[model samples]
Target: MLNDFSPAAAASSFSPAFSPPEVSQPAPPTFTSPAAAVAAAARLAPRLFEQAARTDEVGGFPTQEFAWLRETGLLTAALAPALGGAGLGEPAAALALLQVLYHVGRGNLAVGRLFEGHVNALLLIQRFGKPAQVAAYAADARAGHLFGVWNTENPAHGVRLNFLAGGTYRLHGAKTFASGAGHITRPLLTGALPAHHGWQMLVLPADEQPPQLDRSFWRPLGMRATASFIASLERLEISADCLLGQPNDYYQQPWFGGGAA
Candidate 1:
């Protein structure tokens, strides 16, 4: 079982040096079309596979593999050029994105899961987030920050987004089956607001504090490298800028409620 701890206690356990360093911006690559993006993924296949085998055996985080992804610029290939990505222009952008994911999945399912979430986070920011939010996250991706989404909640202690007096918010409760629990830089999660009104989506730095992890919660024999864990987030302060879409936006129709799923 994952024991909950106060924010202060969690803060005390972490060293400042554990925080990820700020990454410098790298020059964006130019991709004329979807085919170009596919080719790049093809070139990276061997390396991704080589690392995947080791990660699966170890059953921990794939840190070194992630670094390789960052260095190769394959992590941000799905974003638009303006966002410092390899410009995989549309009409075939969706197909191109799928191709990249397929190749990555072939190499390693766990890393592929993380990469897929990263792409989803970028797409969410592109579609619903404010201009500034989009730019900030895009810059982070360009700087090699990995993103993920964690929506699973514990029924006994569902996650809540409580509005604070200072115009900020604090998270309470835990998310279960959270993949890349410790390694993901920016993780997008959903929680219910007060009064049972609606849900809200927010992004926060996963490594800011040492989140209590129930490592044993994940016992799958396959994709063990994912490092999925139960995360207890009790009284975790959240900045105003971290809020992504509006309340209940996560369940909106046509996109989520409709056939798009």
Candidate 2:
């Protein structure tokens, strides 16, 4: 049976540890109507699919196509209405995202998957962040800035995070298959601090350079446009502002975990 991921289902499945702690007020929905958002998604779905082939071959981002995404206001659909977003609930937003992924996958699965990650990051900020944080990210998203999550943990204790004395955090390990790394303006990266309780995510500016980036590692049979390159961080300096939320917000919930793929 095709799973119907409704709001009630989401609430029931949400783990208490991962849930947002009690606050004074609840945030409002960003989308007004599910039907309107789905209709809008349908319009952009075909074009994204049409360009998927070329996007894959070039090992580059579908920049122009994403520009169209911005024009359609689909990019800001995850933000709350107060932050100038569509104000749709999670179920409606996920449905729209599924539609986008379906079309993108028709020509290039890589692009579709990458787009899914981008949307997921936006959803994360919308859900767990403070008002100021949401406003900042929402503004950038509305202005056509792209974002994505960069967490590819392996089964064998692959990744580790370290905290330095000078208010800088270092990522000791490597992240493989960082989809849309090259094209994303912002990367929602996840790593753990040494001796810390859990993992933390940071919104790293994409302009920052990693100590070691091997382009050849990305040479693959498919999904070339994704630029899923391997990058190493001996000791990257990330300011405090780079941190996304409180120490445990990243790994707490499965809501931020699912990708369109």
Best by lDDT: 1
Q: How does model 2 score by TM-score?
A: 0.75
Looking at model 1, residue 199 earns an lDDT score of 88
Question: For residues 1-261, could you state the per-residue lDDT of candidate 2 as single tens digits?
Answer: 012212122212111111111333323224465455556667667777677667666446566666655566666666666666665436646665565456545545775566677677888887666677778887777666677888884424345667678887766665667666556767787877667667787776655633344445576656777777554544557777677787778766566446423
Give lDDT tens digits, candidate 1, residues 1-261.
Answer: 444523343323322111343654454454656677788777877888887767774346677777666666776776777676764424347677778878877877888887777777676667668999988888777776778778887677778988889898988888887777767778888888899878888888666744665656676775777867777777788888999889888766644532122
Clashing pairs in 2: 29-87, 30-86, 30-87, 30-88, 31-86, 31-87, 31-88
Per-candidate TM-score against the hidden true structure? 0.85, 0.75
**Cα lDDT, all candidates:** 0.71, 0.61
**Cα deviation of 175, candidate 2, in Å:** 0.8
